[model samples]
Target: MIDYQLDADGLATLTWNVADRPMNVLNQASIAAFTKAVERAISDPSVKGVIVTSSRPEFVAGGDLDLIRNIRDVAQSMDCSGPVSRILRRLETSKKPFVAAVNGSALGGGLEICLACHYRIVADDPNIQLGLPEVTIGLLPAAGGTQRLPRMIGIKKALPYLLEGRKADPAKAFEAGIVDAVVPSSELLSRARAWLLSAPAEAAIKPWDRKDFRFPGGSPQSPGPIQIFFGASGALLAKTQGNYPAQEAILACVYDGCQVDIDSGLKIEQRQFARLAISQSTKNMIRVLFYDMNDANRLAGRPKDVPKRSFKKVAILGAGMMGAGLAHVASTAGLEVVLLDVSGDAAEKGKAYGAAILEGQVARGRIDESVRDATLGRVIPTTNYSDLADCDLVIEAVFEDRAIKAEVTRKAEAAMRVDAIFASNTSTLPIGGLATVSKRPARFVGMHFFSPAEKMPLVEIIRGAGTSEETIAEALDFARRIRKTPIVVNDCPSFYANRAFAMYPYEAMTMLAEGVNPNLIENAGRKAGMPMPPLALIDEVSVELLYKAMKQARADQGSSYCAQPQDAVLIAMVEQFGRLGRKAGRGFYDYPSDGERKLWTGLTEHFPRAEKQPSVEEVHERLMYSQSLEAARCVGEGIVSVRDADIGSLLGWGFPSFLGGVLGQIDTVGLPQMITVCDRLAQHMPERYAVPQILRDMAASGRTFH
Candidate 1:
């Protein structure tokens, strides 16, 4: 809600506070109310100046995304966007000075509102961030942000914030010409009023309003503008691989807007925002990045019947890299951690790993030595099983063998309390198979943390057949406590992430054997927006482990298993060439101690490159589509929800966020079109590329997975 109050000094303050909402967002109702408030202050002869501030902690977060997503067409988008721009224009042209009192973060349209004011004075809070970050969620700043930001800061300086949607601290905001001054939080309102009254009437006018105004970075015809616009095309392609329409739209908006006047520039921005709004890419991004991500982090499917459980102490078995990282995260969250290993020395070494991490933080000034010591002190390292007696939960981070996991399951359960839950940090093994060895199968679950657990954000919570809702709720709670995003999944070998992720390297190997150039394969992977090239990723995950996982999967599933044609490639590399992986300093790519690694030239001897090589587009589809189709199968099998599928793909294995995860890719390409592509791919590799029945059904019904 917007409230207007006039001070005795002829200064009016408009306060923002949305009812029943923690943050103020510019929705239709709010925008209408805001326009009315702005009109009141501007029209009143008694009110000489206006100071805009928030009653809440933050000034305004941004436009309500629900409203943005509701935009069905250009008409609807313009209907939503037009009034705000008109109101801001009226405010700036009223000849009544306006000062923005940014008490906290002013992001997206929030900052755009500030840009319409005569001056912006931010509270010197360390937590405040100011920027136009709409591009992050597949939209540009439609409320004159694209036009105003570039005009204020110049195109070259503003491109990073607009293109990448980077947030800036209060100090950086002042430096970036986003704010005129940064004052203490207590003085924010007072300073705003003072500036509003003292600032010259001519200064209140926007740069575009002045007859002498010139484009800060020159028009599109200027050399700098020419180079920036043309140069940005190749740079953005290299970064995004042309997978995201939003990035290209951003560049287009900035370039096109800069060529015209302020009114025309605002029109260009609004038109571009409309185009991006209706884009399938934008819809997919909003679905996964905003809605699905929020649901996963909030534990949407958490059983309402089960009461929340707070984990006070946790025991970790096998104090290796995974276990050590677990100890660090747990202790960092102020939970008591018992790190156990086969020997006291090994456990101590794990504790030492935590100490080292804490020391690094202290050295970096992230924490003091006292806090480091306190966090390190929380981790109790010992070989004795009795040390885990008081622990509320236990996580087994041992080897990925079923026998070894079962052995630790028995030992950990013997020491754990009867009601305490048990979890495995296995990347590939099925939770149901491991739960069979547990005394309390109902409390057994899988908390699959990726490698370097302290860093990776996702934790795939696998539910066994007998695992209770209480166990899932408790696991999710614990994951949230450690600041990790948890995605609940059904019991399946490799579960969600690894199951789909394996397709990348598999396709790369298949291509290699088919005489595609190794360089081309890796280049396509990078161009397709994977975090690392397929060959490099294989090296990091290790080829020997891949082979072992394949063998285990084949043996366990028997006739139901899908045998990949590229299995022989992995076998030959690990067994015949004696190249285990990065660990062995050799694999698909040779890893040397001195410099950057390159594709093994010897690959040509084993599988010679074809004279007629596949194009990057063909290779990119093979690698990405293989994973996406497998993800569709996972959804069909009910191993994961559509939301979880998207979240897991992005956070779990570094799927391109711009593509909005795997399901997003399907939506972007269209369900029927994706099916057609999969059908074509199946012609080449039926075992890997076969379309799931669910996808076929959806295509027939004209329905999307999301």
Candidate 2:
């Protein structure tokens, strides 16, 4: 894993090249090898100095997160980081000068290793990123990162990278004082060698090791530290609402670690790292964000017998916002797209939307003009059905009406080739019903793209009863091609995401009608870590549209539909008050052409205020418990698996990441406690808050969702 070589110039090179792995990660075996290499370089008669570099395109990713995840307890977690910390400490204190030649991404423990060297010279590659991003995975950097970074860049300046997990390219890293020099990729080694040969022996001792050295931003009692630490504490509480322990732990590491000597500081960071590594929050985040997300991306559990497929051409049958956005994203991903509509003019209008978005990208310097032109040129717009002749797939993003969808399916299928698949982007309609018009029922699937398809990261793939495994695999592959995360679900009205998501707004509206202050309701949603307050989200999705969905559900589900109680709130806002939504500049809140919006003060007139109201905690519980209960019901009914339910709740509806996802929330707040809360709420709203039998059994058994 560590190759040690001494040249005629007395400069030793330690190249990291872990066998059988694409990228080198600092694990127990590699750290032990590195320690031996360091001792050899220090004692060898022929070696005068050392140069640390990589044998691959990138240096290292970070410490082995898999190892961190497998830790049985705090002692094991400490053991995981303790070795690397000691190795880095010995290298930094060695009398012989050491320089790092960073080739590519040096994140987390990777950058921590570089910080221990006397000097760092990076290749001038735009793709090379450098930073300590341990906090993103819910741990502070344990290998002297907290102590070394602030000593080099000052505490105030280093806070952003530590807090936000920000990384920078070579130029930015140099500007941020993370690296000593930037050179051409070809000259990186030569530059490191030259620095080692020319620099005095005293350069081996870091500034932090000097007895007379003062901290860059002054001591912890200085004005900058006082303001940044206190101000950031308040901001963090407001942003996270104390839901994430990692953020606060990071703050604690920096504040306390910077107050002592370098070695003591590293010890402080190590203990904190162990504490957070074993935390349930960190464990939940790793399982969902890393393990589950990676599994979904690879299409795990897909039929192994099915052959791999690639999508080359696609046809979108509509010219509205959803269709146009799909065309833009498809073309951007190097696929030929045929955008169709009722007429040539309408189709051209849809094409123009993509052009406008690319032009905006050009204005922001994200892409050059030539690239924009090339991307837009791949989209062919026309009204004729013949344009879809050679297409591999056709997605019908027409209006959400069963009759309209069935009509489009029949028309588009006639133009599609024999092997082509048909997909529907219906938000609420079932895929099995829409597939009735397809001649090859097994080839039909649902690829439900969220609104503004070009930007949303998630695409919910729904499989009807008759859909073939081949078709499902192809749909998932296509979703990957478009750079969208997918979670497979079985066909149902609203499928998984939308079915559970509707409960969020319904509960919010119920609160509104019961005379809870609109402002309080909105604040509670934000404090609960929802991306948007339920009312604000309703306005963006359109109050009129939600009312129509509710009406449709009532007609289809009969008088016993659970959302009926929330209908009065939607009716008064859309019909009686003439407040359609944000598009109409009025709803539960007023959206003006200019300036900020506030709650429409007239809401109390239609729905009178009550003599007493529920606490903010009660309102928050209603919002979260309602959606989570529905998610569990979806899981119990087999509409979605346990992992997919959590994935959908997170990417589809913006469920808070700190809670992991809907199912994760059950684990965060113990299952039995969630059951108790659900029982209390069910006393008044049993239809929405009643716990599923599966949840009750799990609570009784003391089992978690994981």
TM-score of each: 0.94, 0.95
Candidate 1 local lDDT, 1-706, one digit each (tens): 9989998999999998887676999999999989999999988999989999898988889989888888889999899888998898788889989999999899988998999999999999879999888888888888888888888888888889999999998998998888999999999988987787788878778888888877777766789878987888889988787878888888888888877888888888888888999877787778788888898888888988889898899999999999999999999999999999999899999999889988888899879989998898899998988998999999999988889999999998988999899999998888888888998999999999988888999999999999998999999999999999999999988899999988899999999999999999999998888989998899899889899888888888899987678888988897799888898898888877999898888899988888899888889999999899989899999999888989999988988876789888887778887778788888978888889899889888889765
What residue pairs are clashing in model 1? none
Highest TM-score: give the candidate number: 2
lDDT of each: 0.89, 0.88
Candidate 1 lDDT score relative to the true structure: 0.89
Instruction: For model 1, give the 10-residue run with minimal summed lDDT.
Output: 213-222
Measured by lDDT, the strongest candidate is 1
**Which 10 residues in a row give candidate 2 its minimum summed lDDT?**
556-565
Give the C-alpha miss distance for residue 277 in model 2, angstroms.
1.6
